[model samples]
Each structure stands twice: as structure tokens, then as C-alpha cells.
Target chain A: MSDQMTEGYITEDGRKIGGTLMEMKNITLRFGGVKAITDISFDIKEGEIRAIIGPNGAGKSSMLNVISGFYVPQEGEVWYKGAKRPQMKPYQVAQQGIARTFQNIALFEGMSVLDNVMTGRLNHMKTNMFQQAIWKGKAEKEEVENREVVEKIIDFLEIQSIRKTPVGRLPYGLKKRVELARALAVEPHLLLLDEPMAGMNVEEKEDMSRFILDVNDEFGTTIALIEHDMGVVMDLSDRVVVMDYGKKIGDGTPDEVRNNQDVIDAYLGVSHD
Target chain B: MFYREAGDFKTTYADDNQTFPIKFDRYRYYAVLFFAFLIVPFVINDYWVNAVFMPFLIYSIAAIGLNILVGYCGQVSLGTGGFMAVGAYAVYKLMTAFPEVSIFIHILLAGGVTSLVGVAFGLPSLRIKGFYLAVATLAAQFFLVWLFNKVPWFYNYSASGQISAPERTVFGIAVTGPNTAAWATYLFCLIFVTICALIARNLTRGTTGRKWMAIRDMDIAAEIIGVDPLKSKLSAFAVSSFFIGVSGALFFSVYLGAVEVGEVFGINKSFLVLFMIIIGGLGSIFGSFAGAAFLVLLPVLLKNVLVGMLGWPTDLAAHLEFMIVGALIIIFLIAEPHGLAQLWRVAKEKLRLWPFPH
Candidate 1:
């Protein structure tokens, strides 16, 4: 594993996968007496689509929250880029090259689609209030530069037609796409998506799957997504971690996880004492 | 036909991101500026200046400030009067202490002082929100009013506890105090209004504006997107207070020339500014101006029609004015919560598609 970390590896499809981008070691998150996620550990590698698959109440979302710095685990540290990440505010975590979308859409409904996407570039805009107030040289140049990046993402996501429309007015699938565009605008090294296809139709799901793959292929962004769709997990992810009752039940490549007896038993409703 | 953007094309991001992207709206803005600076100053008399122009311009600044906090930033502050008092008192002290300095500098300095106080008061906003935050700001209103009224230094140890602006000048023309010409006062406030509106507009359309709106729209998402809530909320409070303070300075120095803190900068004044934004439209620069003009004109219109023409009692007209404003606010909230700015936007939308309905 250490040798592979230095040399990298080529997948079956010939895509290069880099060393560990983020590793969660013995993470235990609790809410009062209830453990939302207990003693779960996983690592997401660079340039690979990783999936966290599980049944309802499996703490998949909670694990994603911990990675995004929304929650701090009771035990163990989150190692990112081979360094232990100190517990910080979610915004601070976001500034460290991490971005995410929520289970329910979290678009700023009052603003235009363009404005919503521009917000993803907040970490990049360096102009102060005084410069922005005058808006002549530094502020104007920064705005245009950031606008170019946002526009590229918007074009890539094919949401240019509704650029000026308010986010609240858009349909759910398009809003999800805008959210993705916003997260992509961060140009993050690691993107965590929480239920990207929660309420989509068959066609919408297929489109989302394509976009996820395209994002991974084109930007080489490491993605760790929590998905319920078994087909989507098998097709999109290079490796899978399966969880049930706030515990990791299986972890391997999609084929290995599919054949793991524990994962099958968890899916088949095995009785627990 | 004139309002349409059919022939206009923006070839660059800067052009597309301009305050007024359309040629017609841009021209209209220039026209308004030309008229305000060159036209209105010439024909204005004392009655027009005192009753119409001065209050309109001063309140417009206040409205714009309040709109930044309540309208754009979505932080409901009921402490406009308190913040304004800070400006008024600060200017009063500055004017007396530095009698030789330009009144413009005093006003600007007063705004700076008020921003500090605003930020101090704004600290509570980090932990509280909605009506609870409003209550927090309400405490600021009452406490500030009390401080000004009780403290002798605030009013320069005046026998009546009233702070009055001494005669102050710009380019040898008296712009404050009793001896000033109508045009000097009008142009003085007009200058401040122009600068405030320009700054407000620029800030709201730029990165700062986006941060404020992001926090306003959804705070958790804004945080996760890397917007610092401390910076955004505090900046909103500070900037909002600065404008309110400037207006307060102008209110005492130019508009009224003398003010008692308790009666002038009280709970009622806070509500008045809040109502201006609510009526004018939240989150709109034009709405601030529109709301200010509407409120200022409402009283004059009521006096002329109810008392001047109908020979009704003055007090009755005042009562009727309150009733009309209350009813309009209710109607606006229920029917058009976006206020007059949205109405103007819808009207323009229709004008763009005129002569055909699909």
C-alpha cells in the first residue's frame, strides 16, 4: 500500500488513482446518548468516485457531515492530504478545498442562478469592502475573473438558459444541477455529495450519473457520495463502503461488496440481538 | 418602446454586471442625476427645501441604510433611531470641538463613530435572529435615547438638553444653521445622498452584497460555502449604521438645525425608517428613494388636501395620515411584499413586452 501510494495505480478502465486524499480513522459521533455514527473508519483516494451505501438510519449522512466539518466525532481525527485536520468551523473547512451539496437542496432561493453559482467562488474573491464599494479596479477585475470561472461551470452544467432566473423558480433537478455548479465553482480537490439523486426521475438520475462521472473524469476531483441506488453505486464508484445501524458492514470494490456475506445479510434483513 | 433592451448588447462581463445594464435605464439614471444636481437646486424655495427636499434626501439616506440591514442582509434592526442618535451626538460634539473644520468632515466622522456603535450593537446578531434580534436592536434604541437625554455632554450642557448645529459652511456658502440658504442645505444633503446611494449600490452589486444576501437567504448554506458570518453580519451592521448616522447628522445640522434626543431620535423614528424600507421595497436602491419620497410627500399631500383644501382640523389630518400609512403598509405586505421596487420591475417587464401579448 505504501509503495502504491508513491507510484499510484491504474484502474481497469485506465484512469489514474492517486494516494489517500482523506482518511477517517475510528470516528465516533454521538448526539447525547445516541451514537449517530460509531467507530466507523474509511479513506477516500484522489481521482476516484467513492460511494457510501447503506440502508435507512445507517449514519451515512452523519459520516459525510463529519468529513465536511459540520460535526466533530467523539474520538479519532480526520486525516486529509496526510495531515491531521484540526476541528474548525464548516466555513473554515470549506476554505481548505472541500465543497458539498445537501440532501435537500440548499440553493439561495432569493438570488439568481448566476448569483447562486458565484457564491461558490466566495473563497477565491479577495477584494475587501472598500474596493467593492468603489468597484473600479481591483474589485471589478476580481468580479470579472470570478465570473468567468462561474460561467464556465454554468456552461459545463448546461444551466445557462436559466442563469438570470431565481433559484426558487427552478425545478428540483435543475436546482440540484445549480448546486453542483456552485460546489464545482469552489474548484475543490474533494467534493462530498449527499444524496445527489434523492428525488429524481429515471432520466434525471441518468443525467446526474453522467454529470458525476464527467466531473470526476474532467476535473479529476475526488468524490465521496452517499447514494441509495445500488445500480448507481455499482456503475459510478471505484470502491464502496457499506454501513448499517451506524456501523461499517462492508468495504471493498463494488463487486467485492456485492458478494460480501455481511453486506448481503444486512440487505436481506438479518435479525440482530 | 423606450424601456426595451432589444438593441442593447453587453459584450463584456463588466458591462453585463453594471448597475443598470440596459441603455434606457442607464440613460434614465443619468437624467435623474442631472436633474437632481442641476435642476432642483435652482428652483427650490425654503418651503420646498424644508418641507420637501431636505427631509426627502435625509430620510432617503436613512432608508437606504435600513434597507441594507433589513432588506438586503435580512437582519431586522429596530435601532435605527439609536444609531442615528450616535451620529447626531457625534457630529454635535465634533462640530463644537472642531469649529474650524468643514461640516462635511464632521458628518463623515459622525458616520464613522456610529458605525462603531453599530458594530458593538451588531455583536448580538451573531447569536440571535428574527424577532429576537429585533428585540435586541430595540434595546439599543431605548438605551441610546436614554444615554443622549441623560448625558449633558451630548447636548453640550445646553439648558434645554437640545443639541443644535452651529453655523457651518462649504466653499464660503453656509450649509447648516439658521442663516443658510435653501439651495445650500438642499445641495449639501443632495451630495451626501448621491455618495451614499452610489456606495450602497456598488457594495450591494459586488462581492459584499453577495455575501450579505447569501447569509440572508440561507445562513447554514452560506457558512458551508465559506462565507464568514462574523464578517458579513458585522459589516452589514457597521455599513448600515454609517448611513443611518450620516442621515442623523444631516437631520440635526441641516434639516431641523436643533433636536432633543428623546423626542427626535426615539422609538417612533426607528419605526419610521423601518416603514420606509418596507414600503419602498427591501433589497432595492430605488426602493429606498421611492419609499422616502412617498413618506415625506404623504404628510404634505395630506395637509394640502385634508386641511388646506377641505378646511379640516390639522390634528384630524395627522390622524388620517397615520391611518392611510397603516392601511397602505398592510396592503403592501399582503399584496406586494417586495414593495414599490418590485412594482416598478413588473411595470418595466410589461413595457418590454408591450404591443403584443402571447
Candidate 2:
């Protein structure tokens, strides 16, 4: 069952205003009239864990996809940080310090776990091909600097033992952790985690939840995660957003959203016999 | 015990991201290149040069080109032979039209011409991939090879439907053709391969190479990462074709000294290089050279020992060569799809522990 909550983001000034770091204004997305997401207006704040929870067909993934620039909204202005963001590519979004992990484990399976994480440093690596080829000047220095940073991330994720192991051979939970570690490697301003703990076991989920909290507290990274586990969402998120059939059904703090009537109806189905 | 990365040290990123990160690997590579370029020229006689070094270097270049397409970008191209034809014919046409011009420059320029043609064929990869994409490139191979046969101009109106290498040179020293010294031809190929391999390595590690790998790994995800599939895939086609074209020119100039489309550079040549990549390693640069060398030498070694010495029938020896190569392909794919690269890796892994891998 969906949790009872309406969540909104905090303003950039650290105020409790229902303002947002990213405001998806009147977003209408369609997969040829299917209305995958319709007229959805939601804002994610500067420094909070904003969770999006809904039924399977509720288009949570679609909304996340739209935010990350994977899918262009049929009609919407996506306001991020301060000004309205024009439609941009996903790497542009990544360049803007927004990084994400997929619901399914989407890693470079053929590459080592370390190489997979190293790919996250792609945007940060500044040297060109000539520099890399000669390996004498700037490229070598940047590579070392990046490996230092990536090593810290790997250590943080406790994946040092399997650093050189190809991601294909890693267990499901470890793969999920590597995916999170990869997203974290970007040192993002906002982290979008789509079902970060979907297939993780209880112990793995608990470790992931702790890692998620540490990432939020340590880096002060604004996180917008989608979770099917209501309990984990309730325990971890500062605010929650609820959707039903692609529309934002409820938006507040955990307790206020918990008591919203529409939120109640969406989950309990209004109980019409 | 079989695979571990316990004590690999990296004092720098260059150290870590090296073509061969391990100390042992660096030594092995230098040693091999030293042999191939320096020592082998002196040790090998003229017959060995004609039958071995020439084909090996030419095929090595072609394998690296194919590796760029299939290994790095994940595009299967059966049209490598066609690109080679483009190079050979381009050289033939250029030489016929401008007889006074230096032949060496024409051979080099033919690669550029082939690159353009390759990208044109590679355009279909935008819409297709995997087996379907392979089929599309098969079209490129058959079409181009057929064109060389049908159009008499490519053969310079010769009755034999073939083209011979012009007496080409860099500085009046014979650099191509049978009369040229083996050392000159070997040196010419060595320079081009070293440069192309360097370029390929840089492209693979840097922004461009990463873009190709991103597309190769997952096109949809690569798009989300902000890579334009159009630019990335086309660049791969162009770069890959450039190398293939040059190899074609080299095959005509430095090795065969003359070629017919369906004979020297054909679908069979494509298969040979593909097998080289398979036996060497995919997506690893060193694998290209290793595969090329192994595949090229296998038949020669077979003929020398089996047919020449043992008096086995030449036809039987040829069939045996195919059987052994085919079986090796299957074994490499099944046992370690990583190919000789993995074997090299394993050997290095053992050496890292030295004296007591046990």
C-alpha cells in the first residue's frame, strides 16, 4: 500500500517555503495518448530527500526520466537551481551536477567495478587525446587526481575488495551498490535514485539506507529517490510526493501528508462497494 | 588463485591506465615490438619477408581497424574487405592518373579515400545493430569487391582484372614492390601501425574513445549520458575505415605487390582479421597485434613443417590450417572470449606472484 504523505521541497535559502530547487511545471508527458505522465507539477528542494511513491503504472519512472533529460516532456518548463532550464541532453544534466542510478542495475558489465566508477569521472576529466597519448603533461596528473577521488568513493561504498572484479560477476546487491557508488562518483548536487533498493535483501537494504543517509548528511546532496518500500521511504525521506495515474495526488511533511484525505483515497481506493 | 588483483600498485594515473599496467607487461610489449621492428628484419630472410612479415604487418593494421569498429564501438562490419578494396583501387586510380607523382603518397592518400567510403556504408549502423548490422556491412563488402571486378578502370583497363603496386618510395629508396628490400617495406608498415595504434589508444581512453565505448556498451544509456550516437558512431566508422584503407594500400604496396579484389583483399581477408581479433582480444589494443601475428604465422608454420618437411599434400595442409584456425576460434570463444589477451593477463597474473604462484 502507498504511504500516507504529501511532500514538497525546501527553498534554496534554507527556508521551509514550499518552493523548489527543480520545479516541473504542468508537465504533460505521453507515450502516444497513454498519458504516461499528465499535468504533473512537482518541485524538489535544494537539500532534502524527496521520495516519489505510487502504484506500478503511476509513471514515477517517467517523471524521473523527464527530469534527467532522457525523455522530453510534451509540455513543461523545468526550473532548476534558479532559472528555467531549456531542454538539454542527459550529459548536460549530468554536467549540471544531477546524477542518477537506474531501477535495474545499469552498469558497464564488461568493465571492472573500478572502471565503471571511473566512467563517472568522465565529465570531470579535462585532458584531451593528445595529452592522454603523450602521458607526460596534464592528462597523467588529472588521471591520478581522479583515481584518488574515485578510490575514496570506493572505500566509502566498501567495495575495495572487488575493485578490479568485472561488474558482470558481482552479486545483485553489490551491483546495485556499485551503481550507487557510480552516481555518487559524479559528486552531484542532486542525486536521483530510481528504486535504489528494489532487489536488495534486508541486510543489503539496511546498508544502502545507511549509505543513502550518509551521502545526504555528508555531502549535503539533494536526493530525489523512488522506492516501493513505504517503510524505508518513511524512515529515510525528509518529504514525500505521491502520484496516481501520472498526476500528483498529494504534496508536505511526513505527518501532514500521512493525514491527507486524497492521499488516503488514492491508496484505499475510496472503498466504493 | 586464478584471477586476483592483490598487489598492483599505481603511483600515477598513467601508471594505472597504461596499455599494459603491469611492469611485466610493459617489458613484454617493448620486447615484442623491439623484435618485430628491429630484430625480426635481420633474422628473417627475403622469403620470410615476402610470406610472413609483410602479411603480418598488413593484417595487424587491418585487425586494429576492425577492432576499432567491432571491439570499441560494438559494430560488426563484414565490409572491411570492401574498405580495403577502396584503398587498393583508390591507389590504382591515383597512380594511373598521376604517373609522375610519388607512389608512396598515393598509398597513404588512398586510406583517406577509403575512410570516406567507409562512413557512407557505416551510416546504416545508425538504424541497425548486431546480426542485422553485420548483414548490412556484408552488402558493403560484396558491393565494393564486385565493383572492383566489374569496373575495368579500377584495374587500369588491364585484362587480368588486377592492379600492381607502382614503384613507390619516400625518398627514392624502394619502399614498395618485390624489388624493394624487405626492410624498407617492413619499416613503412611499422611507422603507420605505430602511429595508428597510438591514435587508437588515445581515442579509446579519451573523450572520443569513451563516446564509442558508451555507444558500444549501451546506445540508449549512452544517449542519456549526453553522447550523440550520430557523431560517435560515424567517427568510429571513419577512423576504422581510415586504418582499413591504409592496410589495403599496404597489402597492395608492401606485401602482395599486386592484388585481385576477390583474392588478396576479399571477404576471406575480413574473416582472417576477424579471427585475429577473436584470437588476440576484443576491445584491447594489444590484442590486435597478437591476433594478427598468430593467425598470419599459423598457416606459414603449417606449410613449412607439415607440407614442406613432412611431405603432407599441400591441399591437405591447407584444409588442416582452416580446421585448426576454426577450432582455435571456437575454443577461444568458449574457454576465454577475451582471447590471447586473457592468456597474457593470466601469465602476468602469475608473474606478479613469481617464484611461488603455487
Candidate 3:
């Protein structure tokens, strides 16, 4: 498919990583008098691993929040495909094939791992409440089909042993994996991960990096992730967008951002130390 | 050994996801259904029907309804009484206006009418949550009971402000009002209970149930995953109220035969249903029935033993019943917060690992 050209789409290394999927044009977000994101401009290419790396309070999360429609920028036009995106609720954005994982591992604690993943399939379900109540034709069929998809994701993440375990009882690393499985269950065109490897061990980080790469390679899902690990940022991502004090300091390939002097200074000149 | 699944294999998703996944559990459920539908009606008499069976069946339906909202949807509602009042009044109006219509259809319409009221009150849940939403629903409870008491139209301008169910029969057997046979009424209510339980079980095991549980578990996460909080919460309210309404209609027309709004569908009724789910287990259909049965039988059993057998005062037995219920609720909350369902699950797990200690 990469060798077979399709109009405006781009190809790289035998993989299709094409045209702009989501474009944030001069996004400026403010909370009262405090500006969270200031004049941040970036575009996420289709089927590429895009990383937003920054220090604490660098507003990297705020940038992800803006892209997810959680916090609509006070001034900026968000473009999806070629058209300008509208001001809508977070769920409305999800309906437009956008899905995200939370930095805090916001999997439903009381529900079983399987049930939590099933929640991601809510958008694709066409069954009405009455039909579901009666366990009628469409409802039963959809549930079984969705269960297959969810099971495959569970298998993919190698959390099959904890399929029926309540997420509250899971360890931190497994919980993160369950969260990824849930996000993958959405089958989104674009997936957002917020510091997915935060609070994980070295072995867990390696496993998570492999999963992220596999998600991009197999599912062809456009991924926009926020992370602070430089090694992970450089290894897993196709391109990196560096933020410092709510401003875009660097945006390019991992090697390009690695050589950028501003990025070097931002990491070296830490006031806290 | 009793709960072994060594040879049982689920070949498909539907088999795995069925309401009763285990072969033993499935057979046990069928046995219970068989007893309720075929055996009990014939053997039931006035004493057994009035003292035990009827109330259990009716309250089980109501508990299932409330559990769906409070347990599965994670929306705390203190308006069960108000919603039930809507169903009772709706059925009253339907019965008086359309005498020739089947009583079953009137009960169904009563459920529909209550669903509308439920949705209207459920609007506050969209903005408010937790204790705030509970208080809002409490306001609805007071308002609805007051409406039925003050409004002459609801009771049809009766001087006593009482609405009574007139004679209604099905298949040539009287099931409502005076002269209705105890077995006839038992069978009637049993039929409704069976259907409601099946529907509730199906729902709590399906897609909408998952959505409700998701919203209950974490609304923000559910919303981020494309669950519309407004739709999920309101649909939960509607469906929960629909079953509650049907139970209320049965309570009035089939069980009690007459009702005074304040005395019957009051705030106390709301607490009773809430307590049922808490004791049964949150997020479990079987828990609803278990809690209802536990609560209903407690008083009757206390009365029979403490008052009838021991010759104790009636008030003493009644007071003791309250103390026991209160103590049991606290115990369940502290020790087994998952309620009776968790206990059952533990027992089944033990049985599965019998002849060896894990």
C-alpha cells in the first residue's frame, strides 16, 4: 500500500505516513489571567508517532487536552483533515474517530478489566436501550462482535490473565497496559496517550514502547503521545514537538530536535536544580 | 465439586456472556423459574400468598429497578416513591377512563408514564452528582407525594383522597380488587416478576448495562471514550423507573387494592428499596432479589417468632426487627461491601475448589 501511491498521501520506509490528520494552528489557551498554551502550532501527520516532550508544567498535557477537545483553545483554529474543527464536547470529538488515554490511568476502578475495555466500544454500538434490555437480535450480535475485538486487544497487550480482574486490584504496570487496551478498543483513527510510561519500571517501559510501536505498525493508528523520557521520545516517535513554558521550542524528527540548541538549553538550564 | 467447570467449555462469545455462564448456575436458575411458574401457583393459598410470596415478588421488581440506577448507573436517586406514585396514579386514571382495556396494557402504560417523570427528574443528574443529586431526587419524592395528596384530579375528587382498584380480571379469573383469589393474584404478580427479572438480567449483562456501569464507575472517562453522560443517565432513569412503575401499579391494583399517597408511596418506601440493593449487592441483578427477600422475610419471621411464639409484645418485635436490619446493613457494609452476591460468589468459589484448601 505504501508503494501504491494514493493521491495526496505520503509514504515512508514502506509504511503510509501521510497528510495532516489534525492541525493545531497558533493555539493559544488561557485560564483567566494565566496562559496555559501560548502560540503553539503543530500538525500531526496521519499514521505517525508524534511526541510532545516537555518539563513539569510545560503545558504538554494542556496541549493534549486542547487536541482532545477537553479544553478548547481561546484563540486558534483546529483543523481535522482539511476542514476547520468545530467547538464541541469531548465526546463529540471522540465520535469523530479520536480516542485518548489519561495521564492518571483513568480506567474504571470498580469495573472488571473486560468491562472497562468494553466501554470503549460504546461508540460503535448501534443497539438501542430497549433492544439491549430484551437481549434482542442487533444487541446480542453487536456485543459478541465487539467482545471479539476487545479480546484480541487484550491478547495483543498480553493481559489475558487479568481479563476478569477488577482494575482496582491490578498493579500499576498492568493497569497502564489495561488502559492502553481500552484505548485500542476504541479502534480510533487517531490515538492520544498521556505519559503512558510514567511511574513504570525499565522492563515495563520497554514493553510499553514495543506495544506503542506495534499499535502504529499493525493498526496504522495515528498516535500523539506526551512523555518526558528522552530515550523513549527519541526511539518510539517518528517526530517530536518540544514545549517549554507553554511555547513550542522545537518541532521535527527525533535527531533534528536532539541537535536543536534551544532544546539542549531547555534541558540543561533547569532553575529547580 | 459442586461448582466444577472442568469439562464445560464456552465455544462462543454468546455462551460466555450469557446471564448464567456456568452450567450449574444456568440449571439452578431454570429450576427456580420452573418452581415459580408451574409448581407454586397451584400450592399457594391465602395465608402463604399474603404473608410471603406476593410482597417478595413485588418488592423484588422494585429492587431490581432501583439497583439498575443506583448500582449499575452510579446515580443516587431518592425518588423511588415519587416515581412509583406516578405509576399508581397513571394506572388509576387509565383504569377509570378505559374500562374495556386489558389491565396488563394499563400497567405497561403506567410504566411509560413513570419513565417520562423519571427522565424529567433525572435532568438534574446531568449537572449535579453524588449527594447533591440525591437531595434533588428527595425533593422530587416530597413533591410527587404532595401532588397526589393535594390534587383532587389524581384521586378522582374522592373525599377521602383514597384511590382504590376496581375489579379487573384476566382469562376469566379475577386478579384485582375484592373477591380476587389469592392464587390468581399470586400468579398475576409472579408473571410480571419473572418478565421484569429476565429483562433486567438481560440489560445488566449487555451493552447499555456496560455503559451505565462505565458512567457509574467514572463519568469523565466514560465521556472521553464516547459515552454520552446525558443519554446514559436519562436512559437508566427511564428504564429503572419503568420497572419501578410496573411494580407500583401491581402494588396498588393487584397487591394492596387501595392506596393513600402519603401512607403507601412515601419517603419510607424510597429508603426501603435503597436498603434492599445495599444489602443485596451493588451492580448485581441477583442481589436485588436477595435483598428484597431478606428485608421482606425479616419482619414476618420476627413477628412469628418473637410475638407469636415467645408471647412478646408486638411493638417489641417490630423494634427488634428494625435493630436487626440496621445492624445487618452495617455488618454487610463493613465486612462484605459487595453484599449478599459476594457471599454467594465466595461460596461458589469454595465449592469449585472443594477437597483442597487454597
- The per-candidate TM-score of the B chain, in the order shown, comes to 0.98, 0.91, 0.98
User: Which runs of model 2 end up more than 4 angstroms from their true locations?
Assistant: A1-19, A81-89, A126-138, A268-270, B1-9, B93-108, B150-161, B351-358
Query: Each model's C-alpha lDDT?
Result: 0.92, 0.82, 0.90
TM-score of each: 0.98, 0.89, 0.97
For the predicted complex of model 2, DockQ is 0.42
User: Across residues B1-358, which tens digit of lDDT does each residue of candidate 2 receive?
Assistant: 3233457666665666777665555777799789878887777677877788778878888899999999999999998888998988898788778877887678779988998999999899989999999999999999998888998877878878779876767777788655788677777878888888887887786656767877888676666555668877998998899889998887776677788789876788778788889789988888998999898888788788888899989899989988987787787789988889889878866766776766
Error of 1 at B149 (Å): 1.4
- Each candidate's fnat: 0.86, 0.31, 0.88
Model 2 chain A lowest lDDT segment of ten:
A1-10
Task: Give per-residue lDDT, candidate 2, residue B2.
Answer: 22
Q: What class would a CAPRI assessor give candidate 1's docking? A: high
lDDT of 1 by residue, B69-144 (tens): 9998999999999999999999999999999999999999999999999999999999999999999999999999
i-RMSD values for every candidate model: 0.6, 2.4, 0.9
Best prediction by lDDT: 1
- Write the residue-wise lDDT of candidate 3 on B1-358 in tens digits: 6668778888998888887777888899899889988998889899889889998999999999999999999999999999889999999999999989999999999999999999999999999999999999999999999999988999999888999999988988888889989889998998898899889888888878888888998888888999888998999999999999999999999989999999999999999999999989988888999999999998888789898899999888889988987897898789988899889889888888887867
